[model samples]
Target: MKFAQPLWNDLKCQLQDGFILDTSWTNIYLPNAQILGIGKDITAHKQSKQVLNTQIEQEKLMRNIA
Candidate 1:
């Protein structure tokens, strides 16, 4: 099955945040006909990390207040 544009866009965003994107393909007719690909987007990964860190800090603050 082919991936949708929205899904692809999301994947790209994640990649930009420094997350890694991996894909694999295999042929049914040939067991040995397999392919794999992997990539990383440093900018996205960094952004994602920052967002996660901010969320964690917020949660910690809330817990301390409670």
Candidate 2:
């Protein structure tokens, strides 16, 4: 596949075992053709973001009531 084409992309993917991954991918073709990728476990970050959103909504409601 690398020999045919070179490309890069960033995506969030879920594995077959039901795990999620945040991926950063890159392809290079200069001295040699290479494909590189990296990922992080962002489950905690996602949960934190949801909690923050919920807190923001609650704050908004409280301000309106007051």
Clashes of each: 7, 0
Give the alpha-carbon lDDT of every model: 0.53, 0.69
Could you tell me how far off, in angstroms, the CA of residue 12 lies in candidate 2 after the best superposition? 4.9
The candidate scoring highest on lDDT is 2
Q: Name the 10 consecutive residues with the lowest summed lDDT in model 2.
A: 31-40
Report the lDDT tens digits of candidate 2 across residue range 1-66.
445564646577889998877655555555565545444466576678899999999999999999
Candidate 2 ranges beyond 4 A from true positions: 1-31
Q: Give the alpha carbon lDDT tens digit for every residue of 1-66 in model 1.
A: 553322222233334678555433232332356533333445556578889999999999999999
The C-alpha local distance difference test score for the whole of candidate 1 amounts to 0.53
The local distance difference test score of model 2 is 0.69
